[model samples]
Structure formats: C-alpha cells, structure tokens
Target chain A: MENVLELKNLKRHYPIYGGVFRKQVASVQALDGIDLSIRRGECLGLVGESGCGKTTTGKAIIRLDDPTSGNILFYHKEKKDGVDIATMSPRQMKKQGIRSKLQMVFQDPTTSMDPRMLVKQIIAEPLREQGGLSSRALENRVVELLELVGLTKDHPMRYPHEFSGGQRQRIAVARAIATNPEFIILDEPTSALDVSVQAQILNLLHELQQRLQLTYLFVTHHLLVVKYISHRLAVMYLGKLVEIADTDDLFNKPLHPYTHALLSGIPIPDVQHKLKRIVLSGDVPSPLNPPSGCRFHTRCPFVIDQCKSEEPVLEEVESAHKVACHRKNEVRKLVYDQFG
Target chain B: MPKLIQAEDVVTNFYTYEGVVKALNKVGLVVDHGATFGLVGESGCGKSVMVRSMMRIVQEPGQIEGGKVVLFFNGDQQQEAVDLLQQSEAYMEDLRGNHISMIFQEPNAALNPIMSIGDQISESFLFHRKKEMSKKILEDLSADDCRVFLPLKKLQQTLYTIAADNPKSFILIICSKIPILSLWQRRLKREALQRSIDIIRKLSISNPSETVHRYPHNLSGGMKQRIVIAIALACHPMLLIADEATSNLDVTIQAQILELLKDLKKTEIASILLITHDLGIVAETCDRVGVMYAGNLCEVADVEKLFQNPQHPYTKALLESVPKFSQEGRLRSIDGAVPNLVSPPSGCRFHPRCSHAMEICKQTFPEEIEIEENHMVACHLYVK
Candidate 1:
C-alpha cells in the first residue's frame, strides 16, 4: 500500500530567550526526531500527555508550522506525485495544492472557526481560496457539504455560535472535506465535547473517512478515544515516540514502561475489574532540558544505570510492534506482573 | 450513620440577560461521613452548582429557589445532630470555616492574592479559636519570674492600655520597637505566624518557611491547589465539597492532586462530594457515582456497577462513547448534542439523542427504576 503521508526524522524546536540581551538560553525540543507513515485510508492515533508535542508533530506534518528539519512527503496521485512538502516554498506549496491535499480539524471548533462567518461561508472559504468556483456553484456546494455532514441546508445561514460544540465541529469537518483533502489531522476533535456528543462526532469522523477514503492523523490525550478510532497507535513522552504498534497489540502488551504506566493509569469504567494503576512518581520533565539519555528515565520505575547513559532508538520487537526503551523485556515483565 | 449533608429537591436558576437559565432542577444528592461520592456529568450539567449550593457560594443572578440544604453537624457536647441550614447567618458564618469547607478548581482564584499564604491559612484559626488563641497569647506574654520581670509588668500595663481597644494595632506598633514593648509583641506575632507556617507544612508543601511567605501566584498550579486544600482542611470540616478541583490540572498533576485529596479524606475522616465532568477521573477516585443530564440524574450506582452494567441508555452510551486504548479503531460515538436545560425535551431529556429511543420516549418521561440492590436509573428502556 502506498503511503499517503510520510514524516522522516522530523524535528521542531522553539528556542527560549533569556538575560539582558535576550540571548537564546535553551530550546524547547517540541518534536525531537520522529519517523511515521500513514497509508491511504488509515487512522493513526497519536496519544500523549499535554506538552508531549503530539500536536506539534501534527502541525509539522500539515506544514501549519514549518518543521526545524526533516522530510514531509505527500503522495499526490492526481498531479506531480511524491512531492517533498517540507522543502516546498510557500507559494510553490500552494500551487502544488498541498494545503487542499492535507487539511486540519483543530481542537476547539468554537475558537477555530470565525464566529462572524455564516456556516456556508465558513465551509466555502476553502473553495473560495482554491478559486474556480462560480457564485451559484459555490453556494450549491456549501449546501451539499452541510447535508453530507448531517446538517440541514438551512444551517448554511446560521453563524458558528448558533451551533453546539458538536455541530460546530461538524461544520469544521465539512470545511476540511470541502477541499476534498486526502489527509486530515484531527487534533482532539472531540475532547471539548460531552461523552455522548463525542460519540456522535467520532461516528461522524469514521463515516466521513469511510465515505471519503481519507487518511487521518488523530492527536489526543484520551487513550480510550485513540483506541476506538485508530488502527495503529503511537505513545509519545517528552517530545519522543516511546512506542508504536497495532492498537490491540500495544494495549495487550505495552513494551515501553511509560506506555505501560499510561495504560495502567487510565481507570477502566468497569467496577469488577480493578486496575493496579502504576502511579508515575514525578511530573513530566520540562522539554527545555529533558532527562539525559531517555527523556522518560527520571520517572521510569525500571530506570537503570545504562538508561541514563544511552538513549534507546525505536525498534520493532514483534510484527508491527515498536518500542524505544533500554529494557523493553524488563518493562514488559513488570507491566504484566503488575497488570495481569 | 447520620447524613452529613442532605439536599432535597434543590432548584438553582440563573437569571441571565439572555433568559432564565435553569442550572439545577429538583436536583438532590446526599453525602455521608467519611465517604467519597462523585457527581459525574458533562460540561454545564450542574454538578458544580449542586456542590456550590452546600457552601452557599452560588453568586448573584443564580438563586436557589426551592431547596433545603440540611447539614447535620454532630454537636461538640450533646451528641445531637443540628440542622446547620436552620441556623442564623452569623452562626453559618462561624460554621463556614470550621465545620463545612470547600476547595475550588482553580486554587489561585480561590486564594487571596495580596495576603501571604501563611497569613491566609492562619486566618481560619483566628476566626474559629480566637478565645483559645488569646489565652495562649497571655501565657506567652506572662513573665516566668515576676521579681526579675517587674519592668516587664510595667511594660505589660502600658501595652494592655494600648491593646484595650485594638490588640492588632497595639501589637503592630510595639513590634516595630518603641524600645519598651518590642520583645513581648515580637514574641506574640511570631507565635501566631508560626502556627500558620506549621499548617502549611502539614499540607506536605515542599518548604513551609518559604512557601508561607510567598503569595498564591508564586506557586505552581498543583502547589496552589495543595495550599487551597490545606486551608480547606485547616479547620477539620466534616464534609469537603471539591468543585471541579482537579479539572484545570494536567493529567499527571491531576493524578497527584487526586491522590493528595484521597489521602486527606482518610486522615481527616471527612466525606468528600467531588464534582467533575470527566468520567475517567470519577472512575479513578469516586467510590459511588451519579450521572446527571439536563438538570436530572439519569443514573446513580456504585462506580464498578455503573461502568460494567449500566442500565440507563445514557450511561451505556457514555461508556461506549469514551475512546479506550484497548478498543482503538472500533470506537462508536453517540449522536446529537445535549438538550438545552432551560427548555428541556418534553419526554426524556436524552430521548432526542438516544440510539434506542422509542416513540413513548418522545412524549413521556421515565420514572426511576431500581435495577439492582443499589443501582438506580431513569430511562424508558428500563422503566417497568
């Protein structure tokens, strides 16, 4: 299967300024090296705590913010195929139809969408920017898009504020799909919504993906939401990928201690099944100067001397199961012993 | 066991500029001594309002129209439980800091900005135990040997004359050293301030001495929350109402705060009425849970039972909608948004969005049904 989107050795760092001269004191290593690929029609869930840089990784891929360094290859089947988007000039990227090819559904639709814009204008803004749409044709397209996203045609006249959070999100989705993008980054699309409404949004996303055959890079902090929506899952900590595997495999057997602890920390809704929660001792380390060797070593329950001296590269231990840890086997044993 | 707090048919409504917002409608829940009861709901579900009603903290435009919030305080002597709500405002004022305290979600907002953290914490002791405190002050001021302290006695007489009307003012001037009353006044203020510093230390704050002097804004979010918790627990309240206490924190910090609250609950032997929108937090910390929707409790059950075999359609949908790591890629979401509480749906408030909604659900509200010994749900699907 041809990969629709691929990120290779991506890194994005924001420099921190200090002192009288405002000199560059240190850099927040937001996205330390990351390598990931999303196949056509696949949904990859990126799960992490706040400040783990999962959102930064998504922004980097969509070129919402330029990456400090790396390659972002977009496989556009229609036009010039296999374009390196990272190196493309802003004008060239627009001309290459990169923006329309990869769209983003932000975390908060209430804030993301303009409150002043009517639903029709919000959805049609992408089309207007892409050009070549007649006034009558654009209006018709907006109505169709609204209906497709489970809204009435009359909704086109309403403002974003008139809609509920879930409804506004649907309008955002409608806008994302207006350009008919091949890939969409859903950044905590349902986190702002209620559980029941969250379910509706999740179902809508799933249905939209199936109908459009679109690929997704879903970023969220909620593990359960990731589990339900993602075909494969990646666990991030301190701006680094700790584990990546088939969602079921990762949940069944988490190799990285951080991933294991994160999974165990989530309290299951079932009352009969009591979880032996692995309470990580310390807070997430600051990104400015993450721990030596492994960024997770400070809070890792199974930290050893070697873990502090050498950083572990993400390596595949089993089919579609990759982990970055000095002692993957030891971590696995500890997780199973505690959870199983 | 006596009920620590009982709210019967509580109705809180806010008269906003737009319209009358029925924040809470006939909402009722109970908290017993030494138990943690969780009120779980989505945003705008009135969980906060219900707990805020207990503290009489609901602000202007928000009126508690029809409800009796009965707080039964076990008398210090007679062992008889007294209805705190029936007491006068002055009595309630006295009881606020000492009997039933509250910890809010944002610690910075809850704490005083200008006051030193230590002074704010000690204020509780001052308000509740002023007589006992005065006795301790007198003991500290008394000289061990009257003969050697004759000059001290003369100074005490002058200080007493100055303190006859305003002790704080008299002590403040003497502590600045008029040369005569410096030592005694310094000792007095230091003793009171030391007790405040001691409470900060008891909350497990890293450095009590430094933390006591600093204002609320200087501390981290978690540390501020801890300070607020310390102040709330200072007077040993029988019931602590935590209103969205951990909602503002990050997940790891949230875990630590929840753990701290749990530890405090056990040590103080106080009941906690935890209000939150996150079901995951409720599952992690709450022993029993109540689900609210559009100003109505749809279900109430033991945390385990609520999660495993939820009888109400809303509860089942809520559990199903949560995306779990174990069930990635197979997530199912419920359709539709929450109904407006002011003018809720005629029949079942949740019927408009329910997947299993029937025709009768659109016209008639379901009565509460007891599915198990302690589990109760209000949904047409379960109603006999």
Candidate 2:
C-alpha cells in the first residue's frame, strides 16, 4: 500500500490570556508534536482520553484548525507526487480541488446536521457547493448515497429528527461519502450510538470502506470499537503519541505503560475472565501545563527517575511496534510475568 | 435471600402530543438482596422508564399506568415486606431517598448548579437521618450537666421528637422549608454536612471540606460524579439505582467510577439496579443481567449465561453488536429500528428486527420461559 497522508511534527497551540493586557500569558498545548503516516486504504485508529489532541489532529489534517507549525503532506495519486498542504494557504488549497477530497464526519450526528433541511438537501449541499450537478442528477446521487449507507431512497425526503440515533449516524456517513473523499476523518462516529446501532454503523463503515476503497482516520475514546475497526492503532496521551502498533499486538502485549494501563481499563464483557485492571488514580492533568517529561509519567505506574526528567522519543521496540517509554522492556516483562 | 425490590406487570406510559407512548408494556422484574442487577438495552428502549416507574419517579406525563411495585424492607432485615404502590404519598417520599436512592446519568444536570456540594448531599441526610441525629443529640443533652439554655433545650427536644415521629407533618415540613425557623435544624445540618464530608472522602475526593463548599460547575466531571455518588450513599439506602452513571464520562474516569460503585456495592448498599446500554459494564459489574427491548424484558440470566448462551434473538444480536476487540471487520447487526412504542408490533416488540422472528412472534407475545435454571427468555421459539 502507498502512503496517503503524512503528518510531520504537527502542532496546534491555543494561547491562554489573562489580566488587563489580555496578552499571551501561556498556551494550551492541544497538539504539541504529532507525526503520523497513513496508507492509501488502511484504517488508522486514534485512541485517547478526552483532551488528548486526537480530535485536534483530525481537525488539523483537513485545515479546519490551522496548525501552528509542521507539514501536512498529501499524496495526490493523479499528480504522482506529495504536495505539502501546510505550505498552501486556505485559498490555494480550496482552488486546487484538495478541499473536496478531504472531508470530516463529526461525533454528534444531530448537532452536525441541519434540522430544517431534508435528508436530500443535507446530503446534496456538499455537491451543490462544489457545483456542476444537475437538479435531477443531484437527487439521484443523494438517493444513491442513502442506499449505500443501508438507508432507503425514500429516507431522503424525511428530516433528521425523524430518524433514530442509529439512522441519523447513517445519514451522517452518507453525507460524508457523498463527495467521494478518498480519506475521511471519522471522529468518534459510533461513540454516541447504542451497541446495536453502533454495530450497524461500524458494519456500514466497513462495507463502505471496502466498496469505495476509502482510507479512514478513526478517532474515538472507545478502545474496543477502535480495536475492531482499525487496521493499526495509535494511542495518544496529553498532546502526544504514546504508542502505535498492530491492533492485536497493542492489545495483546502493549509496550508503553500508558497503553498497558489504557487497554486494561477497558472492561471486558465477561464475568468469568476477570482481568486485573490498572486503574490509574487521579484525573488527566491540565493540558495548559502538562507534566514536565513524558506526559504520562504523572499517572504511569512504571515511572522512573529518567522518565521524570527526560522525554522518551517514540522508538520501535519490535517489528512495526513503537513505544514512548524509558522502561519499555521492564514494563513488558512485568506485564507478561504477572498477566500472562 | 429475600427479594429487595419486585415489580409485577408494571405498565408505564408517556402521553405526548403525537400519541400515548407505551414505554413499559407489562414489565416484570425482581432484584434480590445484596445483588447487582443490570438492565441492558439500547437508547429509547425504555430501560430508564422501567427503573423510573419502579421508583415512582417518572417525569410529567409519563404515568405508571397499571402495576404494583412491592418493596421488601427490613432496613435491618427484620420486618414484613411492604407494597410501595400501596403506601401514601408521604410514606413514598420518605421511602424514596431513605430506602432507595438513585444516581442519575448526567451528574451535571442531576445536581443543582447553584447549590453547594455540601448542601446537596446534606439534604439527603436531613430528609432521612433526622431521627438518628435527634436521638444522638438527646443522648448528648442528657449526658451534659450544663443547662445554660434549659428552656431552649426542652423546646428543641420536643421539636425533634415531633419531627422524628412525623418528618412530613405540617409543622416540621413547614419549618424544614422555611429558612428562618430552621435554626433548630442547624445542629442536624452540621451533622449531615460532617457525614457528607466523610462520604465524599471515602469516595476518594481529596479535599472534602473544600469540595463541599464548591458549586457543581466548579467541580470536574469525575468529581461531580463522585459527589453524586456521595449523595446517593449518604443515607445508606437498601437499593441504589445507577442510571447510566458512568456513561457520560471518559474511559479512565468511567473506569474509576465503575470501580467505586462496585466497591461501594459490597459495603454500602444491599442491592444495585445498574441501568446502562453498555454490555461491557453489565458483564463486568453485574451478577445477573436483564435485557430490555421496546418496553419488554427480552432475556434475564446470570451475567455469564447471558453472555455465553443467549436465548432470545434480540439478546444474541445485542451481544454480538458490541465491537469485539481485534475483530477489525464487519459485525452482524440487528436490522430495523426499535418499533414506535405508540403502535408497537402486535406480538414481541423485537419481532421486526429479530432474524428468527416467526409468524407466531408477530401474532402474540411470548410468555417468559425458563429454558434453563434461573435463566428466562421471552421468545416464541423458547415458549414451548
């Protein structure tokens, strides 16, 4: 598979102002430094707790929130070369047909959609804004998109509120795929729906991915759902990537202490198989003033002297498995000895 | 063990502008003593309605149409069981927080924004712990020889006696409401606040005194959740209804809250009716699980059994729907949406979505059949 999207040390920092001057007192390091790469048709699941910059990374990729620094290199297949999206201004990117190819689906379905617009209008608005679709052609395309997401063609006539939570999510998916975007940022899409409906949406997404060959950056706090949908997974802590590996490897033998703690936190839906949970005490620290060194050292059980003073760079510990921790081998050995 | 709370053929309905939404259609359930009973279902499946109806706390226009909620109360397990539906309004009001309290889903919305955490938690104590506080004060008064305020002490003693006997009486209720005459309750309020501090501290809130003084908006989601749990546990009620208590929280925070509730179950409450749509929560915390769908209890089994050998199609579908870890593939989803409760399908509410839904399933509702010991399935296939 060829690389579709590459993010090199992307950073999005919001300034925190106070007092009379309203000057830049400090900064909320929302996305301090993110470096990730995606294959043409692979699903990369970004899992993290709240305020971990998973959403910010997704938003920044599409230029929804302009990053403070770093390169967003997009590999346009037609041109046969990578174009640095960071260098191009918003206007330049819009004129180059890059905007239509990059689309996003928000977490909350109801809030993301317009209530007044019928399903057809909502789905067609993207194509309408892009121009060059006849009224009849647009109607047919809207109906086709609805069917692709497992909804009936007739559903295009009804309003969003008329649909159930699951159906509303299906509509959101329909609208996202309407523009034929190669890569879609699904930010917590199934998090709001019920398990049954979540399953439906997941299946629909999988089906759509296969049919359209769509690559996805699946962002969610749901570890289990991410493990199921993503080909590979990346774990994020306070504005930094802690671990990234094959989904099964990460779950079976997580290298990073934070990843280990996070995986164990997910409650297994079984009564007999009682796994020891590494329930981290204390809340996620303020992003405005995160921990000094490795961000997770504050909550990590395997924190050491070196972990407190110096940040550990993301290093490949094994085949394609990267971990950001000073005591990776010791942590893995400890987890294996106790849990295996 | 005796059943802690039993609802027999409970039917609750919400009369909206469109039509009468039959939220609970003859729902029957029984929670045993010292057990964590979980109710699992999707959103809009009436899991909340069933629990709310059992507690008789359904919102406006959502009426408990026809059913009896029989509550077995021994407080210390020494009295005859009483039917809660047969009790008077005042008795029910006393029983609500004293015997059975609830932890709502959204802690932010559940708690009063303006009220301090201390007052919200202490209010539970004031409603339920008046007699205990008054008796303790009386014992102290009798022990102390100093009689500086002899007349005031006598008046206070009489007032406590009256309040303890009938907390909802016009004089006591009026006084409890009117802030001016509540000077007598200052000591009781102080005791309640102290107890609230203790409970909050036990919940792992570091600065209990500081937290108690802050409003709901001042606290984080996890802290607010802890405070809500503290309020629910303030009176040590027999049954605690955690209605999706940890749903709105982050994964780590949710893990903490779930652990807290699970730990508290052993030491605090006798029975916990844990209501949530998350199967992982049910499998982890609950001993027995009840699956609801479109106002019907589809399946009831031990947590292990329900997860392993699910009988009803709906239960099977729901269990399979959860994105299993490492299966980065498509899942077999239950087709069709939950039927409109106003005009639900004639027979089983899940027939339209059930893959094994037979002709008989669409004609008449199936009786709950116990296929195995202690495991019941409400499906036509199992009816024989």
User: Where does model 2 exceed 4 Å of error?
Assistant: A336-340, B75-79, B141-182, B326-329
lDDT of 2 by residue, B1-384 (tens): 678888999999999998999999998998999999999998888999998888888999988889888887753253677877777888888888888989999998999999999999999888788888877766666676747488888877877777767655788777767787778888788878888999999999888988899999988889899998898888889999999999988888888998898889888889999998888888999989999999999899989899999988988888777776535446878787778899998988888887887889899999999899999889888745
Q: What is the DockQ of candidate 1?
A: 0.52
lDDT for A277 in candidate 2 is 80
TM per prediction: 0.89, 0.95
How large is the C-alpha RMSD of every model relative to the true structure? 4.1, 2.4
TM-score of 1: 0.89
**Share of true Cα-Cα contacts across chains kept by each model:** 0.59, 0.77
lDDT of 2 by residue, A84-129 (tens): 9976888888788888888899999989999999999999999998
Candidate 2 CAPRI level: medium
Off by over 4 Å in 1: A19-21, A78-81, A336-340, B75-87, B111-120, B129-205, B214-219, B324-334, B351-384
